[model samples]
Target: MVAPSPYQIVKKLKVSRVLVFRTAQRYRRLGTSDDMQRRGRPVTVTTPEAVKAVREKIRRNPARSMRKMAKEYKMSQGSIRTIVKDKLKMIPYHGSHLTTLFIDEKIFTVEANKNGQNDRIIATDYQSACEKGKILNKTSHPASVMVFAGITADGKTPLIFVDPGVKGVALGQFSLRKPIMDLPARRRPRSSRQRDSRVVSRQFSEFISAVDWPASSPDLNPMDYAVWIYLTEKVSSKNYPSIKALKTALIKKWDEIDDDHLRAVIDAYPKRLKAAIKAKGGRFENYS
Candidate 1:
């Protein structure tokens, strides 16, 4: 090897010094070199006990509002979400039923309930209009009644069909139940490979049948708003044929829904309940 020239040595030293100076400047900006803890607002001020307190409140009632929850438990929504999510391990919930949700159409209201009070008189869908009549069952001659379905996540909600006269969503809602009682048709999970085994397809897995659904919580029921929409479709236009026809139609439509789909809705109950309870009775938001 040939010896390097003095000029080459000087150039190499200059490049090394420039690199060190640039790195030092970057560290100074970040406050690491000066030992300065960069000042910023704290992300979390609530303690773990506070997290647990809010979590317990949510565990008891998921239909309550965040405003109420914050007031009652003294925490913010971010804090609440973190506690409920991280500490409680609750999943963000949505409805299980994969049905064609009708949103664009507004059902005419012959009756006014506390929820859907807007009588905007907008034009309605024709097919929805007919279905609305079946469910809404307006008397037309002296109309002042509404047919609302208060469904819950736990298998169609038994509370609804029982009284159909509760006020709060939890009390007012009914669980979706199948018409017949039989051995669960779901298959079992096994620790085996596909190549070696003949798989038995059960209609429902143990999970599918054994889910304990939440009742009347909107977090789980995306269709809860849709159900409200279903009611609006019924009484709108103030032109119904008869009450008997509407009731029969509503009951019929309820029966036609698939059992497995209903179970899926129930699966979303915990998340729905949490949202409703967190919001303290505010409208159930469609987080999806």
Candidate 2:
């Protein structure tokens, strides 16, 4: 018998010419029009119910681990991950920065802050690593002061000096002595850690969802990834003889920070989110 023309195939099969040829080619190669059996194990755990359960769990704790969920749900970690990524379309954000102010704390030392740029020095092989200005005291630690601050797209909160050896409970009360903004609060690591205390948690009860504001994610905060770096670079430009001097430098530079720079950092936040998604909730520093 004669083979049917493309027009006849399309007219009878009700498919486009492209699909008709594709099907014909598949059949010719595989000796069948039906789908070939795919290699590897078939999907078994990522069901609608599983997806719903996983969604509810993550809604309760966005930082909930897939391994923990797998144990709870009696499924493999891979299965739980698939439900999160493919079905629920969730990304494991390091921290959420969608707040009126991005708040964080940093400890500044009296000694020069040793970083990649500042640590490098021109020296011969015989030179000591800790010669003169680079010398670090072995017995005693450098005098350091912790500072807490909040940043907005337009301005920043005054640097609040945190007292030495303050506990979480005391720190929360001390830091939030005055309400900075009328809007809901979201904070970086310090506040996130403070929420672990029952007293501190109560203080943050009026704040945003804990699930959305889990700790240890500085990458998302402009303060952590951007502003702090700038401040550190400027402050570490010269070694301070005392914590008082470091504090003065910090306050002065903080006040002088250009509003335009703040706006630019805040504006880049959405792009950071996209890069985080592309990294599948993993480290996205290189991707960004």
Candidate 3:
């Protein structure tokens, strides 16, 4: 019987056209779908024992360099890498520009959250507001607004507009109790901050509890990665006449983000942890 064409096979199996074509071509030439065995020397260094040793060494100290692992295991660096990647399913990661100390702190936070010690994590940050218009002359500073916002697993809170020239005191006036109280007691919701601003230290100390977030690690914050970026992009796309206009745009955009997208961003926390581990506590480019 004549073999079916690649298109026919793709329609029948619902597989990719390229995959089906390759398989059909192989079958016609070799009379089988399996690949023809290639002639080459068998791999001897990547034995079961070597794979186990590599895994153990990584488990003991994930920070060990690949070159060091190669020397310790008495194998070529390429072999060690292959064993770690192909067999052990490990990826070498380096922390972002943040120092090793900050990376360690982030890893601990991620692990603690994963283990359910802190069930709810909210990310909060301040965006330096900017004015859009032509700069006709030099030394003219653009009028800006300081916008504060927070995001949780469920969604974002209302935009907190900070008054001009007021710094940490703004947080003191802004109420965080409503958001915290809304969560169940069992969740033990906690917020994260990069620094102990006066408001956080004085006011937050009195009522709200927050975790010490890594200052340099914006990737760990959904506010930085998801909400702020999205909001800034939307706000910047159109020109606003005054700070009030910008504030209105900010609130509208914040409200427009649906729950589904917010939940997706929150759900990515575990994947981010895995990416961090794979990168060996380094900065990861892609979380999704």
Candidate 4:
């Protein structure tokens, strides 16, 4: 195809620049907005000591979430997270770091630029396995063990901790060998991409499906998003008779969903697809 006219190219470039600026301004506006800051009451934890405490906690335990620290320290999590990322500089844990370590550093490289520099590899874990490739069975009970479990907007359900259970799909441990942390419905988390599993674990490959991956998206899974909305509504209003009752309720609701409700969700997938593309491959939080 022929290139656009120079005037048209300039116009397109201008629009792109304006769009970038607008996005930045929107984020800035959201940050400076009063949505989080209370309508009244003076701030208490603005002192340098409190700020230092937040950074130290973040540095010591990079995987410890902001909300958890806020609860334990009696501070706001958003404030803590913003301060940590802006000042201390730590990436809140990603799925790539969840394993005990990589299985082989000899050849495996992390997802990096098309140029392929060795700098992309995470220094310590070039090769690791999930405690010796134990989940090889297609019939495994948690056939889909949602890593994190907790109450959400509607009901108590197993949080979709990790999914598409493929390579790079290891569950993130909160501690050295601990399970992942679960959060309530009020918070949404940022997730990371998983790397492919090593070929030596070919035994588990029978269960992996390419369709499950869906074009580098967190937005594709219906059970991950739409179903959560239903679950939250179902559980929050009524008190569960017991923990077992909660489990039964979750299973039932999950099964009871019919085709039409699912189709409506399928219909929205394109919009999400567009948003992801427009965002230049950025995450679009289902909650947000």
Best by TM-score: 2
Worst lDDT run of 10 residues, candidate 2, spans: 183-192
Error of 2 at 280 (Å): 1.7
Where does model 3 exceed 4 Å of error? 1-140, 169-174, 178-218
Clashes of each: 34, 0, 7, 12
- Give lDDT tens digits, candidate 4, residues 1-288: 995754565587776655555555666878642344458767666557777888777668767877888788787777777666665665675553111111110110111112233213233343433333322222222212222332222223333333343233343332212212243323223332233444424647565566554476564444456655465555433334454555555556655665466456655656876776777766775531
Q: What are the lDDT scores of the predictions, listed in order?
A: 0.45, 0.74, 0.61, 0.47
Better of 3 and 4 by TM-score: 3
Native-referenced Cα lDDT, model 1? 0.45
Over all chains combined, what TM-score does candidate 2 have? 0.49
Candidate 2 backbone collisions, by pair: none
Q: After superposition, how far is residue 173 of candidate 2 from its true place, in Å?
A: 4.1
Task: Report the Cα lDDT for residue 237, model 4.
Answer: 34
Off by over 4 Å in 1: 1-228, 231-238, 280-284
Tell me the lDDT of candidate 2: 0.74
Candidate 3: the clashing residue pairs are 93-279, 93-280, 94-282, 95-281, 95-282, 95-283, 96-283
Model 3's TM-score against the true structure? 0.41
What RMSD does model 1 have?
Answer: 20.2
- The local lDDT score (0 to 100) that residue 125 gets in candidate 1 is 75
Q: In model 3, how many backbone clashes occur?
A: 7
Using lDDT as the measure, which candidate wins? 2
> How many backbone clashes can be found in candidate 1?
34
Ranking by TM-score: 2, 3, 1, 4
Estimate, for each residue in 1-288, the C-alpha lDDT of model 1 and write its tens digit: 995554565586665655555556768688555544548875464677787677777778776676677667666777767766777788656444332211111122234332234433233775665565434433454433333333333333211233334333332222222311221222111121121111222422543221454345343344544444444454333443554554454556555555565455545555666777888757766542
